[model samples]
Target: MSALDRSAATPARVWLIWVALVVALAVPIAAAAASPLLAWRGPVYIAAGFAGIAALALQLVQPLLAGGHLPGLSAYRGRRLHRWVGALLVLAVVIHVAGLWITSPPDVVDALLFRSPTPFSNWGVIAMAAVFAVALLALLRRRLRIGPRLWRIVHMTLALVIVLGSIVHAVLIEGTMETMSKVALCALVFVATAKVVADLKGRAKRSASP
Candidate 1:
Protein backbone atom coordinates (compact mmCIF):
# COMPACT_ATOMS: atom_id res chain seq x y z
CA MET A 1 0.00 0.00 0.00
CA SER A 2 1.00 3.59 -0.56
CA ALA A 3 2.09 5.77 2.37
CA LEU A 4 -1.22 7.67 2.19
CA ASP A 5 -3.15 4.42 2.14
CA ARG A 6 -1.33 3.15 5.20
CA SER A 7 -1.94 6.42 6.98
CA ALA A 8 -5.64 6.24 6.20
CA ALA A 9 -5.84 2.72 7.47
CA THR A 10 -4.04 3.47 10.72
CA PRO A 11 -6.79 5.58 12.27
CA ALA A 12 -9.43 3.03 11.37
CA ARG A 13 -7.39 0.27 12.92
CA VAL A 14 -6.82 2.33 16.04
CA TRP A 15 -10.53 3.00 16.38
CA LEU A 16 -11.28 -0.68 16.05
CA ILE A 17 -8.86 -1.45 18.83
CA TRP A 18 -10.38 1.27 20.97
CA VAL A 19 -13.85 -0.14 20.41
CA ALA A 20 -12.72 -3.60 21.38
CA LEU A 21 -11.14 -2.23 24.54
CA VAL A 22 -14.29 -0.33 25.47
CA VAL A 23 -16.42 -3.41 24.98
CA ALA A 24 -14.02 -5.56 26.94
CA LEU A 25 -13.98 -3.15 29.84
CA ALA A 26 -17.69 -2.34 29.85
CA VAL A 27 -19.23 -5.77 29.54
CA PRO A 28 -17.98 -6.95 32.89
CA ILE A 29 -19.32 -3.97 34.79
CA ALA A 30 -22.64 -4.26 33.03
CA ALA A 31 -22.84 -7.96 33.72
CA ALA A 32 -21.89 -7.44 37.34
CA ALA A 33 -24.62 -4.88 37.80
CA ALA A 34 -27.21 -7.10 36.16
CA SER A 35 -26.11 -10.19 38.05
CA PRO A 36 -28.30 -11.74 40.75
CA LEU A 37 -25.32 -11.42 43.09
CA LEU A 38 -25.87 -7.68 43.50
CA ALA A 39 -29.55 -8.08 44.29
CA TRP A 40 -28.99 -9.07 47.90
CA ARG A 41 -26.33 -6.50 48.75
CA GLY A 42 -27.13 -3.24 50.55
CA PRO A 43 -26.54 0.07 48.82
CA VAL A 44 -23.24 0.58 50.62
CA TYR A 45 -21.87 -2.76 49.55
CA ILE A 46 -23.23 -2.34 46.06
CA ALA A 47 -21.61 1.07 45.78
CA ALA A 48 -18.32 -0.34 46.99
CA GLY A 49 -18.42 -3.17 44.48
CA PHE A 50 -19.24 -0.81 41.62
CA ALA A 51 -16.50 1.53 42.71
CA GLY A 52 -14.07 -1.31 42.55
CA ILE A 53 -15.35 -2.22 39.12
CA ALA A 54 -14.97 1.37 37.93
CA ALA A 55 -11.44 1.42 39.27
CA LEU A 56 -10.59 -1.78 37.45
CA ALA A 57 -12.01 -0.40 34.21
CA LEU A 58 -10.01 2.77 34.68
CA GLN A 59 -6.90 0.68 35.17
CA LEU A 60 -7.29 -0.65 31.64
CA VAL A 61 -7.62 2.89 30.26
CA GLN A 62 -4.51 4.19 32.06
CA PRO A 63 -2.09 1.91 30.27
CA LEU A 64 -3.65 2.54 26.90
CA LEU A 65 -3.37 6.31 27.38
CA ALA A 66 0.17 6.08 28.76
CA GLY A 67 1.23 4.04 25.77
CA GLY A 68 -0.35 6.57 23.36
CA HIS A 69 -2.41 3.75 21.90
CA LEU A 70 -5.77 5.52 21.76
CA PRO A 71 -7.07 6.43 18.32
CA GLY A 72 -6.65 10.06 17.17
CA LEU A 73 -5.28 11.29 20.49
CA SER A 74 -1.87 12.95 20.56
CA ALA A 75 0.62 11.90 23.19
CA TYR A 76 0.08 15.16 25.04
CA ARG A 77 -3.70 14.62 25.07
CA GLY A 78 -3.25 11.02 26.06
CA ARG A 79 -1.09 12.01 29.02
CA ARG A 80 -3.57 14.67 30.01
CA LEU A 81 -6.40 12.14 30.00
CA HIS A 82 -4.19 9.72 31.87
CA ARG A 83 -3.73 12.27 34.66
CA TRP A 84 -7.45 12.97 34.89
CA VAL A 85 -8.30 9.29 34.81
CA GLY A 86 -5.67 8.65 37.45
CA ALA A 87 -7.41 11.10 39.72
CA LEU A 88 -10.74 9.40 39.10
CA LEU A 89 -9.16 6.04 39.81
CA VAL A 90 -8.01 7.38 43.16
CA LEU A 91 -11.50 8.64 43.93
CA ALA A 92 -13.06 5.31 43.02
CA VAL A 93 -10.67 3.47 45.31
CA VAL A 94 -11.42 5.78 48.20
CA ILE A 95 -15.14 5.31 47.70
CA HIS A 96 -14.71 1.58 47.49
CA VAL A 97 -12.82 1.38 50.76
CA ALA A 98 -14.90 3.96 52.58
CA GLY A 99 -18.16 2.31 51.60
CA LEU A 100 -16.86 -1.01 52.76
CA TRP A 101 -15.74 0.57 56.01
CA ILE A 102 -19.15 2.07 56.60
CA THR A 103 -20.71 -1.31 56.06
CA SER A 104 -18.08 -3.33 57.99
CA PRO A 105 -15.57 -1.31 59.97
CA PRO A 106 -13.79 -4.28 61.46
CA ASP A 107 -13.19 -5.86 58.06
CA VAL A 108 -11.67 -2.64 56.79
CA VAL A 109 -9.51 -2.39 59.88
CA ASP A 110 -8.39 -5.96 59.55
CA ALA A 111 -7.54 -5.42 55.89
CA LEU A 112 -5.61 -2.28 56.69
CA LEU A 113 -3.78 -3.87 59.59
CA PHE A 114 -2.85 -6.89 57.48
CA ARG A 115 -4.77 -9.13 59.81
CA SER A 116 -7.57 -9.97 57.43
CA PRO A 117 -8.15 -13.71 57.10
CA THR A 118 -9.07 -13.39 53.45
CA PRO A 119 -6.16 -13.39 51.02
CA PHE A 120 -8.16 -11.14 48.70
CA SER A 121 -8.30 -8.45 51.37
CA ASN A 122 -4.52 -8.47 51.67
CA TRP A 123 -4.09 -8.07 47.94
CA GLY A 124 -6.70 -5.33 47.83
CA VAL A 125 -4.98 -3.42 50.62
CA ILE A 126 -1.60 -3.73 48.93
CA ALA A 127 -3.00 -2.50 45.65
CA MET A 128 -4.77 0.38 47.38
CA ALA A 129 -1.53 1.49 49.04
CA ALA A 130 0.37 1.29 45.77
CA VAL A 131 -2.33 3.33 44.06
CA PHE A 132 -2.12 6.02 46.71
CA ALA A 133 1.68 6.06 46.58
CA VAL A 134 1.68 6.40 42.81
CA ALA A 135 -0.74 9.32 42.92
CA LEU A 136 1.31 11.10 45.59
CA LEU A 137 4.52 10.61 43.66
CA ALA A 138 2.98 11.83 40.44
CA LEU A 139 1.58 14.90 42.21
CA LEU A 140 4.98 15.65 43.75
CA ARG A 141 7.04 14.82 40.71
CA ARG A 142 8.06 18.43 40.14
CA ARG A 143 8.43 19.31 43.81
CA LEU A 144 10.45 16.16 44.46
CA ARG A 145 12.75 16.94 41.51
CA ILE A 146 12.57 13.34 40.35
CA GLY A 147 14.42 12.80 37.10
CA PRO A 148 12.48 11.49 34.11
CA ARG A 149 14.15 8.09 34.02
CA LEU A 150 13.75 7.52 37.73
CA TRP A 151 10.15 8.72 37.65
CA ARG A 152 9.25 6.39 34.81
CA ILE A 153 10.93 3.45 36.50
CA VAL A 154 9.23 4.07 39.83
CA HIS A 155 5.85 4.76 38.23
CA MET A 156 5.92 1.66 36.06
CA THR A 157 7.03 -0.55 38.92
CA LEU A 158 4.17 0.63 41.11
CA ALA A 159 1.83 0.21 38.16
CA LEU A 160 2.79 -3.42 37.86
CA VAL A 161 2.13 -3.94 41.53
CA ILE A 162 -1.28 -2.28 41.30
CA VAL A 163 -2.23 -4.29 38.26
CA LEU A 164 -1.18 -7.64 39.66
CA GLY A 165 -2.53 -7.01 43.13
CA SER A 166 -5.87 -5.70 41.92
CA ILE A 167 -6.27 -8.60 39.54
CA VAL A 168 -5.53 -11.13 42.23
CA HIS A 169 -7.79 -9.32 44.67
CA ALA A 170 -10.67 -9.33 42.22
CA VAL A 171 -10.12 -12.94 41.21
CA LEU A 172 -9.94 -14.33 44.71
CA ILE A 173 -13.04 -12.58 45.96
CA GLU A 174 -16.40 -14.31 45.57
CA GLY A 175 -18.04 -10.93 45.46
CA THR A 176 -20.53 -9.04 43.30
CA MET A 177 -18.50 -9.12 40.12
CA GLU A 178 -19.75 -11.91 37.85
CA THR A 179 -17.16 -14.62 37.42
CA MET A 180 -16.67 -14.74 33.65
CA SER A 181 -16.85 -10.99 33.13
CA LYS A 182 -14.50 -10.45 36.03
CA VAL A 183 -11.99 -12.87 34.53
CA ALA A 184 -12.22 -11.20 31.12
CA LEU A 185 -11.72 -7.72 32.61
CA CYS A 186 -8.72 -8.88 34.60
CA ALA A 187 -7.21 -10.51 31.53
CA LEU A 188 -7.62 -7.34 29.50
CA VAL A 189 -6.08 -5.32 32.32
CA PHE A 190 -3.00 -7.50 32.20
CA VAL A 191 -2.81 -7.29 28.43
CA ALA A 192 -3.08 -3.51 28.42
CA THR A 193 -0.43 -3.17 31.11
CA ALA A 194 1.94 -5.54 29.35
CA LYS A 195 1.47 -3.67 26.09
CA VAL A 196 2.28 -0.31 27.68
CA VAL A 197 5.34 -1.69 29.45
CA ALA A 198 6.55 -3.18 26.20
CA ASP A 199 5.96 0.06 24.36
CA LEU A 200 7.87 2.02 26.97
CA LYS A 201 10.79 -0.43 26.78
CA GLY A 202 10.84 -0.20 23.00
CA ARG A 203 10.87 3.60 23.13
CA ALA A 204 13.67 3.58 25.67
CA LYS A 205 15.70 1.21 23.51
CA ARG A 206 15.18 3.29 20.39
CA SER A 207 16.15 6.49 22.19
CA ALA A 208 19.32 4.84 23.47
CA SER A 209 20.28 3.70 19.97
CA PRO A 210 22.81 5.64 17.85
Candidate 2:
Protein backbone atom coordinates (compact mmCIF):
# COMPACT_ATOMS: atom_id res chain seq x y z
CA MET A 1 0.00 0.00 0.00
CA SER A 2 1.04 3.61 -0.53
CA ALA A 3 2.51 5.58 2.39
CA LEU A 4 -0.51 7.80 2.72
CA ASP A 5 -2.87 4.85 2.64
CA ARG A 6 -0.77 3.02 5.21
CA SER A 7 -0.82 6.00 7.51
CA ALA A 8 -4.54 6.45 7.19
CA ALA A 9 -5.14 2.79 7.91
CA THR A 10 -3.35 2.95 11.21
CA PRO A 11 -5.70 3.30 14.17
CA ALA A 12 -2.75 4.53 16.20
CA ARG A 13 -2.34 7.44 13.82
CA VAL A 14 -6.02 8.25 14.12
CA TRP A 15 -5.71 8.26 17.90
CA LEU A 16 -2.68 10.51 17.64
CA ILE A 17 -4.54 12.91 15.38
CA TRP A 18 -7.39 13.13 17.86
CA VAL A 19 -4.96 13.80 20.70
CA ALA A 20 -3.24 16.51 18.72
CA LEU A 21 -6.55 18.17 18.02
CA VAL A 22 -7.40 18.18 21.73
CA VAL A 23 -4.12 19.88 22.54
CA ALA A 24 -4.57 22.38 19.73
CA LEU A 25 -7.99 23.26 21.12
CA ALA A 26 -6.53 24.03 24.54
CA VAL A 27 -4.10 26.64 23.21
CA PRO A 28 -6.78 29.13 22.20
CA ILE A 29 -8.75 28.56 25.37
CA ALA A 30 -5.72 29.60 27.39
CA ALA A 31 -5.22 32.67 25.25
CA ALA A 32 -8.84 33.78 25.47
CA ALA A 33 -8.89 33.55 29.25
CA ALA A 34 -5.87 35.89 29.47
CA SER A 35 -7.63 39.08 28.43
CA PRO A 36 -9.76 41.50 30.49
CA LEU A 37 -10.88 44.56 28.52
CA LEU A 38 -13.80 44.32 26.09
CA ALA A 39 -11.60 44.77 23.06
CA TRP A 40 -9.18 42.09 24.19
CA ARG A 41 -11.93 39.79 25.39
CA GLY A 42 -14.02 39.32 22.27
CA PRO A 43 -11.55 37.42 20.16
CA VAL A 44 -10.56 35.05 22.93
CA TYR A 45 -14.09 34.16 23.89
CA ILE A 46 -15.04 33.81 20.23
CA ALA A 47 -12.29 31.30 19.65
CA ALA A 48 -13.40 29.26 22.62
CA GLY A 49 -17.01 29.50 21.57
CA PHE A 50 -16.16 28.14 18.14
CA ALA A 51 -14.51 25.10 19.70
CA GLY A 52 -17.63 24.20 21.62
CA ILE A 53 -19.91 24.72 18.67
CA ALA A 54 -17.64 22.72 16.43
CA ALA A 55 -17.64 19.86 18.88
CA LEU A 56 -21.41 19.77 18.83
CA ALA A 57 -21.46 20.01 15.06
CA LEU A 58 -19.07 17.11 14.70
CA GLN A 59 -21.05 14.97 17.14
CA LEU A 60 -24.30 15.75 15.40
CA VAL A 61 -22.81 14.82 12.05
CA GLN A 62 -21.10 11.60 13.14
CA PRO A 63 -24.08 9.29 13.55
CA LEU A 64 -25.43 10.19 10.17
CA LEU A 65 -22.11 10.00 8.32
CA ALA A 66 -20.10 7.38 10.18
CA GLY A 67 -22.21 5.71 12.84
CA GLY A 68 -20.54 2.36 12.37
CA HIS A 69 -17.00 3.59 12.92
CA LEU A 70 -16.59 2.51 16.54
CA PRO A 71 -17.56 -1.05 15.74
CA GLY A 72 -14.76 -1.37 13.26
CA LEU A 73 -12.30 -0.79 16.08
CA SER A 74 -13.80 -3.60 18.14
CA ALA A 75 -16.97 -5.62 18.19
CA TYR A 76 -20.00 -3.59 19.27
CA ARG A 77 -17.64 -0.86 20.47
CA GLY A 78 -18.78 1.75 17.98
CA ARG A 79 -22.18 2.26 19.60
CA ARG A 80 -20.58 2.93 22.96
CA LEU A 81 -18.14 5.40 21.44
CA HIS A 82 -20.99 7.11 19.62
CA ARG A 83 -22.97 7.46 22.84
CA TRP A 84 -20.07 8.79 24.85
CA VAL A 85 -18.89 11.28 22.24
CA GLY A 86 -22.41 12.45 21.52
CA ALA A 87 -23.03 13.13 25.21
CA LEU A 88 -19.72 14.96 25.47
CA LEU A 89 -20.64 17.14 22.49
CA VAL A 90 -23.96 18.06 24.06
CA LEU A 91 -22.21 18.99 27.29
CA ALA A 92 -19.74 21.18 25.38
CA VAL A 93 -22.58 23.07 23.69
CA VAL A 94 -24.28 23.63 27.05
CA ILE A 95 -21.08 25.00 28.50
CA HIS A 96 -20.57 27.21 25.46
CA VAL A 97 -24.02 28.76 25.73
CA ALA A 98 -23.70 29.01 29.49
CA GLY A 99 -20.50 30.97 29.11
CA LEU A 100 -22.29 33.41 26.85
CA TRP A 101 -25.12 33.72 29.34
CA ILE A 102 -22.71 34.33 32.18
CA THR A 103 -20.98 37.05 30.28
CA SER A 104 -24.25 38.78 29.41
CA PRO A 105 -27.33 37.44 31.14
CA PRO A 106 -29.74 40.07 29.92
CA ASP A 107 -28.78 39.59 26.34
CA VAL A 108 -28.95 35.82 26.65
CA VAL A 109 -32.36 35.95 28.24
CA ASP A 110 -33.57 38.22 25.51
CA ALA A 111 -32.13 35.92 22.91
CA LEU A 112 -33.60 32.81 24.47
CA LEU A 113 -37.19 33.98 24.46
CA PHE A 114 -36.98 35.66 21.09
CA ARG A 115 -37.33 39.20 22.49
CA SER A 116 -33.75 40.22 21.70
CA PRO A 117 -33.56 43.12 19.25
CA THR A 118 -30.37 41.84 17.68
CA PRO A 119 -30.59 39.83 14.45
CA PHE A 120 -28.18 37.16 15.68
CA SER A 121 -30.14 36.57 18.85
CA ASN A 122 -33.07 35.07 17.04
CA TRP A 123 -30.87 32.71 15.09
CA GLY A 124 -28.94 31.73 18.20
CA VAL A 125 -32.15 30.84 19.97
CA ILE A 126 -33.32 28.76 17.07
CA ALA A 127 -30.02 26.88 16.91
CA MET A 128 -30.04 26.32 20.67
CA ALA A 129 -33.59 24.99 20.47
CA ALA A 130 -32.65 22.63 17.67
CA VAL A 131 -29.78 21.23 19.71
CA PHE A 132 -32.12 20.76 22.67
CA ALA A 133 -34.59 18.95 20.49
CA VAL A 134 -31.89 16.64 19.19
CA ALA A 135 -30.91 15.83 22.76
CA LEU A 136 -34.53 15.13 23.63
CA LEU A 137 -34.89 12.81 20.71
CA ALA A 138 -31.75 10.94 21.71
CA LEU A 139 -33.02 10.57 25.26
CA LEU A 140 -36.31 9.17 24.04
CA ARG A 141 -34.92 7.25 21.09
CA ARG A 142 -35.72 3.80 22.39
CA ARG A 143 -39.20 4.69 23.57
CA LEU A 144 -39.92 6.48 20.33
CA ARG A 145 -39.00 3.37 18.33
CA ILE A 146 -37.47 5.58 15.71
CA GLY A 147 -36.10 3.24 13.09
CA PRO A 148 -32.49 3.68 12.16
CA ARG A 149 -33.16 5.16 8.73
CA LEU A 150 -35.86 7.54 9.93
CA TRP A 151 -33.84 8.59 12.92
CA ARG A 152 -30.80 9.27 10.79
CA ILE A 153 -32.83 11.40 8.42
CA VAL A 154 -34.45 13.46 11.16
CA HIS A 155 -31.24 13.87 13.08
CA MET A 156 -29.34 15.12 10.04
CA THR A 157 -32.12 17.54 9.12
CA LEU A 158 -32.12 19.05 12.58
CA ALA A 159 -28.35 19.19 12.52
CA LEU A 160 -28.49 21.19 9.33
CA VAL A 161 -30.95 23.61 10.90
CA ILE A 162 -28.71 24.03 13.94
CA VAL A 163 -25.64 24.70 11.82
CA LEU A 164 -27.49 27.20 9.68
CA GLY A 165 -28.81 29.07 12.69
CA SER A 166 -25.44 29.00 14.36
CA ILE A 167 -23.70 30.36 11.27
CA VAL A 168 -26.15 33.22 11.10
CA HIS A 169 -25.63 33.92 14.78
CA ALA A 170 -21.86 33.85 14.49
CA VAL A 171 -21.76 35.96 11.37
CA LEU A 172 -23.94 38.64 12.93
CA ILE A 173 -22.12 38.73 16.28
CA GLU A 174 -19.82 41.75 16.32
CA GLY A 175 -17.68 40.61 19.19
CA THR A 176 -15.38 37.78 20.27
CA MET A 177 -15.02 36.36 16.81
CA GLU A 178 -12.68 38.56 14.86
CA THR A 179 -9.58 36.36 14.89
CA MET A 180 -8.71 33.99 12.06
CA SER A 181 -9.12 30.98 14.32
CA LYS A 182 -12.71 31.88 15.12
CA VAL A 183 -13.50 32.54 11.48
CA ALA A 184 -12.04 29.22 10.35
CA LEU A 185 -13.92 27.33 13.02
CA CYS A 186 -17.23 28.81 11.92
CA ALA A 187 -16.36 27.96 8.34
CA LEU A 188 -15.68 24.38 9.35
CA VAL A 189 -19.20 24.17 10.79
CA PHE A 190 -20.61 25.22 7.47
CA VAL A 191 -18.40 22.80 5.58
CA ALA A 192 -19.29 19.98 7.93
CA THR A 193 -22.98 20.65 7.45
CA ALA A 194 -22.56 20.68 3.69
CA LYS A 195 -20.64 17.41 3.83
CA VAL A 196 -23.42 15.77 5.80
CA VAL A 197 -25.93 16.77 3.18
CA ALA A 198 -23.67 15.54 0.42
CA ASP A 199 -23.22 12.20 2.15
CA LEU A 200 -26.98 11.80 2.53
CA LYS A 201 -27.52 12.65 -1.11
CA GLY A 202 -24.90 10.17 -2.20
CA ARG A 203 -26.58 7.44 -0.18
CA ALA A 204 -29.93 8.25 -1.71
CA LYS A 205 -28.49 8.14 -5.17
CA ARG A 206 -26.87 4.77 -4.60
CA SER A 207 -30.07 3.33 -3.19
CA ALA A 208 -32.03 4.51 -6.18
CA SER A 209 -29.59 3.18 -8.75
CA PRO A 210 -30.74 0.06 -10.58
Candidate 3:
Protein backbone atom coordinates (compact mmCIF):
# COMPACT_ATOMS: atom_id res chain seq x y z
CA MET A 1 0.00 0.00 0.00
CA SER A 2 1.10 3.54 -0.73
CA ALA A 3 1.80 5.82 2.21
CA LEU A 4 -1.26 7.87 1.48
CA ASP A 5 -3.38 4.77 1.10
CA ARG A 6 -2.05 3.28 4.30
CA SER A 7 -2.81 6.53 6.06
CA ALA A 8 -6.31 6.59 4.60
CA ALA A 9 -7.49 3.15 5.69
CA THR A 10 -10.88 3.67 7.28
CA PRO A 11 -11.34 3.66 11.05
CA ALA A 12 -14.60 1.85 10.38
CA ARG A 13 -12.60 -1.16 9.33
CA VAL A 14 -10.74 -1.16 12.63
CA TRP A 15 -14.00 -0.87 14.53
CA LEU A 16 -15.38 -3.86 12.68
CA ILE A 17 -12.25 -5.84 13.48
CA TRP A 18 -12.57 -5.05 17.16
CA VAL A 19 -16.25 -6.01 17.16
CA ALA A 20 -15.50 -9.32 15.47
CA LEU A 21 -12.76 -10.11 17.99
CA VAL A 22 -15.13 -9.32 20.87
CA VAL A 23 -17.67 -11.77 19.49
CA ALA A 24 -15.02 -14.43 18.94
CA LEU A 25 -13.68 -14.04 22.44
CA ALA A 26 -17.18 -14.06 23.90
CA VAL A 27 -18.11 -17.46 22.45
CA PRO A 28 -16.14 -19.44 25.06
CA ILE A 29 -17.38 -17.22 27.84
CA ALA A 30 -20.96 -17.58 26.69
CA ALA A 31 -20.51 -21.32 26.45
CA ALA A 32 -19.23 -21.46 30.00
CA ALA A 33 -22.18 -19.39 31.20
CA ALA A 34 -24.76 -21.47 29.37
CA SER A 35 -23.42 -24.85 30.39
CA PRO A 36 -24.28 -25.74 33.94
CA LEU A 37 -22.45 -29.03 33.37
CA LEU A 38 -19.20 -27.17 32.99
CA ALA A 39 -19.81 -25.58 36.37
CA TRP A 40 -20.34 -28.95 37.93
CA ARG A 41 -16.98 -30.07 36.60
CA GLY A 42 -15.44 -26.83 38.01
CA PRO A 43 -16.30 -23.49 36.44
CA VAL A 44 -13.00 -21.88 37.31
CA TYR A 45 -11.09 -23.50 34.47
CA ILE A 46 -13.54 -22.31 31.84
CA ALA A 47 -13.90 -18.86 33.37
CA ALA A 48 -10.15 -18.41 33.57
CA GLY A 49 -9.71 -19.58 30.00
CA PHE A 50 -12.26 -17.05 28.71
CA ALA A 51 -10.83 -14.18 30.74
CA GLY A 52 -7.31 -14.90 29.53
CA ILE A 53 -8.42 -15.01 25.91
CA ALA A 54 -10.27 -11.71 26.29
CA ALA A 55 -7.28 -10.02 27.89
CA LEU A 56 -4.89 -11.38 25.27
CA ALA A 57 -7.07 -10.27 22.36
CA LEU A 58 -7.55 -6.79 23.81
CA GLN A 59 -3.82 -6.32 24.28
CA LEU A 60 -3.16 -7.39 20.73
CA VAL A 61 -5.80 -5.18 19.10
CA GLN A 62 -5.67 -1.95 21.13
CA PRO A 63 -2.66 -0.52 19.32
CA LEU A 64 -4.11 -1.10 15.88
CA LEU A 65 -7.41 0.38 16.88
CA ALA A 66 -5.69 3.49 18.17
CA GLY A 67 -3.72 3.97 14.96
CA GLY A 68 -6.58 3.43 12.51
CA HIS A 69 -7.76 6.44 10.55
CA LEU A 70 -10.56 8.06 12.44
CA PRO A 71 -11.99 11.35 11.26
CA GLY A 72 -11.61 14.31 13.58
CA LEU A 73 -10.20 12.08 16.32
CA SER A 74 -7.71 13.84 18.53
CA ALA A 75 -4.46 12.17 19.59
CA TYR A 76 -5.53 12.51 23.18
CA ARG A 77 -8.78 10.71 22.43
CA GLY A 78 -7.05 7.81 20.77
CA ARG A 79 -4.59 7.47 23.66
CA ARG A 80 -7.42 7.68 26.14
CA LEU A 81 -9.13 4.80 24.41
CA HIS A 82 -5.91 2.82 24.56
CA ARG A 83 -5.61 3.45 28.29
CA TRP A 84 -9.18 2.42 28.94
CA VAL A 85 -8.79 -0.79 26.99
CA GLY A 86 -5.60 -1.57 28.89
CA ALA A 87 -7.40 -1.09 32.18
CA LEU A 88 -10.14 -3.42 31.08
CA LEU A 89 -7.55 -6.01 30.09
CA VAL A 90 -6.04 -5.86 33.56
CA LEU A 91 -9.46 -6.45 35.03
CA ALA A 92 -9.93 -9.46 32.81
CA VAL A 93 -6.67 -11.02 33.96
CA VAL A 94 -7.64 -10.49 37.56
CA ILE A 95 -10.99 -12.14 37.05
CA HIS A 96 -9.35 -15.02 35.24
CA VAL A 97 -6.83 -15.70 37.96
CA ALA A 98 -9.28 -15.09 40.76
CA GLY A 99 -11.62 -17.68 39.37
CA LEU A 100 -8.78 -20.15 39.16
CA TRP A 101 -7.80 -19.35 42.71
CA ILE A 102 -11.30 -19.89 44.00
CA THR A 103 -11.53 -23.26 42.33
CA SER A 104 -8.12 -24.54 43.32
CA PRO A 105 -6.36 -22.18 45.62
CA PRO A 106 -3.61 -24.63 46.47
CA ASP A 107 -2.87 -25.40 42.84
CA VAL A 108 -2.84 -21.73 41.93
CA VAL A 109 -0.42 -21.08 44.75
CA ASP A 110 1.73 -23.96 43.60
CA ALA A 111 1.84 -22.60 40.09
CA LEU A 112 2.80 -19.15 41.30
CA LEU A 113 5.50 -20.55 43.56
CA PHE A 114 7.01 -22.78 40.89
CA ARG A 115 5.90 -25.99 42.51
CA SER A 116 3.37 -27.11 39.92
CA PRO A 117 4.28 -30.22 37.93
CA THR A 118 2.63 -28.95 34.75
CA PRO A 119 5.17 -27.58 32.31
CA PHE A 120 2.74 -24.92 31.20
CA SER A 121 2.69 -23.60 34.74
CA ASN A 122 6.17 -22.25 34.17
CA TRP A 123 4.97 -20.32 31.15
CA GLY A 124 1.96 -19.02 33.02
CA VAL A 125 4.14 -17.79 35.86
CA ILE A 126 6.47 -15.99 33.47
CA ALA A 127 3.58 -14.42 31.60
CA MET A 128 2.02 -13.26 34.82
CA ALA A 129 5.30 -11.63 35.81
CA ALA A 130 5.57 -9.93 32.45
CA VAL A 131 2.06 -8.59 32.82
CA PHE A 132 2.92 -7.27 36.26
CA ALA A 133 6.04 -5.63 34.88
CA VAL A 134 4.07 -3.93 32.16
CA ALA A 135 1.54 -2.74 34.70
CA LEU A 136 4.30 -1.34 36.87
CA LEU A 137 5.84 0.46 33.94
CA ALA A 138 2.51 1.94 33.02
CA LEU A 139 2.02 3.12 36.58
CA LEU A 140 5.46 4.67 36.90
CA ARG A 141 5.80 5.71 33.30
CA ARG A 142 5.10 9.39 33.91
CA ARG A 143 6.97 9.77 37.16
CA LEU A 144 10.05 8.07 35.73
CA ARG A 145 9.94 10.16 32.59
CA ILE A 146 10.25 7.05 30.47
CA GLY A 147 11.70 7.71 27.04
CA PRO A 148 9.83 6.60 23.95
CA ARG A 149 12.52 4.23 22.66
CA LEU A 150 12.97 2.46 26.00
CA TRP A 151 9.24 2.13 26.50
CA ARG A 152 8.82 0.67 23.04
CA ILE A 153 11.52 -1.94 23.58
CA VAL A 154 10.28 -2.99 27.00
CA HIS A 155 6.66 -3.08 25.91
CA MET A 156 7.38 -5.17 22.86
CA THR A 157 9.57 -7.62 24.79
CA LEU A 158 6.97 -8.14 27.48
CA ALA A 159 4.28 -8.52 24.89
CA LEU A 160 6.21 -11.36 23.28
CA VAL A 161 6.61 -12.95 26.66
CA ILE A 162 2.86 -12.74 27.25
CA VAL A 163 2.04 -14.33 23.92
CA LEU A 164 4.54 -17.12 24.32
CA GLY A 165 3.50 -17.91 27.84
CA SER A 166 -0.18 -17.87 27.03
CA ILE A 167 0.33 -20.13 24.06
CA VAL A 168 2.28 -22.63 26.11
CA HIS A 169 -0.40 -22.59 28.78
CA ALA A 170 -3.09 -23.21 26.20
CA VAL A 171 -1.19 -25.99 24.50
CA LEU A 172 -0.62 -27.80 27.76
CA ILE A 173 -4.25 -27.56 28.77
CA GLU A 174 -5.87 -30.03 26.42
CA GLY A 175 -9.46 -29.65 27.48
CA THR A 176 -9.81 -25.87 27.51
CA MET A 177 -8.75 -24.92 24.00
CA GLU A 178 -10.27 -26.27 20.80
CA THR A 179 -7.54 -27.96 18.78
CA MET A 180 -7.79 -25.90 15.59
CA SER A 181 -8.33 -22.59 17.33
CA LYS A 182 -5.37 -23.16 19.62
CA VAL A 183 -3.06 -23.93 16.74
CA ALA A 184 -4.27 -20.92 14.76
CA LEU A 185 -3.86 -18.57 17.70
CA CYS A 186 -0.37 -19.84 18.43
CA ALA A 187 0.65 -19.41 14.81
CA LEU A 188 -0.64 -15.85 14.86
CA VAL A 189 1.36 -15.15 17.99
CA PHE A 190 4.47 -16.56 16.37
CA VAL A 191 3.98 -14.34 13.34
CA ALA A 192 3.39 -11.32 15.52
CA THR A 193 6.65 -11.94 17.37
CA ALA A 194 8.55 -12.25 14.09
CA LYS A 195 7.00 -9.05 12.78
CA VAL A 196 7.97 -7.13 15.89
CA VAL A 197 11.54 -8.37 15.66
CA ALA A 198 11.74 -7.42 12.00
CA ASP A 199 10.38 -3.94 12.68
CA LEU A 200 12.88 -3.37 15.43
CA LYS A 201 15.76 -4.50 13.27
CA GLY A 202 14.62 -2.34 10.37
CA ARG A 203 14.45 0.69 12.65
CA ALA A 204 17.96 -0.01 13.87
CA LYS A 205 19.26 -0.33 10.34
CA ARG A 206 17.75 2.98 9.30
CA SER A 207 19.12 4.71 12.37
CA ALA A 208 22.62 3.37 11.68
CA SER A 209 22.66 4.51 8.01
CA PRO A 210 24.25 7.82 7.14
Instruction: Give the number of the best model, judged by lDDT.
Output: 1
Q: What tens digits encode model 2's per-residue C-alpha lDDT throughout 12-103? A: 76677556545444544444444343454464355446655455345433543243322124324545565666666677677777777766
Q: Is candidate 1 or candidate 2 better by lDDT?
A: 1
Per-model TM-score versus the true fold: 0.93, 0.69, 0.76
The TM-score measured for candidate 1 stands at 0.93
Count of backbone clashes, every candidate in sequence: 0, 3, 0
lDDT value for model 2: 0.63
Candidate 3 worst ten-residue window by lDDT: 63-72
Sort every candidate by TM-score, greatest first: 1, 3, 2
**lDDT leaderboard ranking:** 1, 3, 2
Residue 166 Cα positional deviation in candidate 2, in Å, after optimal superposition: 1.9
User: Where does candidate 2 stray beyond 4 Å?
Assistant: 1-20, 23-31, 34-79, 96-104, 208-210
**Model 2, residue 154: what's the lDDT?**
85
Q: For residues 70-189, what per-residue lDDT tens digits would candidate 3 score against the true structure?
A: 333455776677677767877887887888898889988998899998888888788878877887898999899999778878877887787788778767875555556656656655
Mind sharing the TM-score for model 3? 0.76
Comparing 1 and 3 on TM-score, the stronger one: 1
Per-residue lDDT for 1-210 in model 1, tens only?
A: 223533665766967987898798879988888978777889999999899999999999999889866767766888999999999999999999999999899999999999999999999999999999999999999999999888888999999999999999999998878899999899989998998888888888898799
Q: Quote model 2's TM-score.
A: 0.69
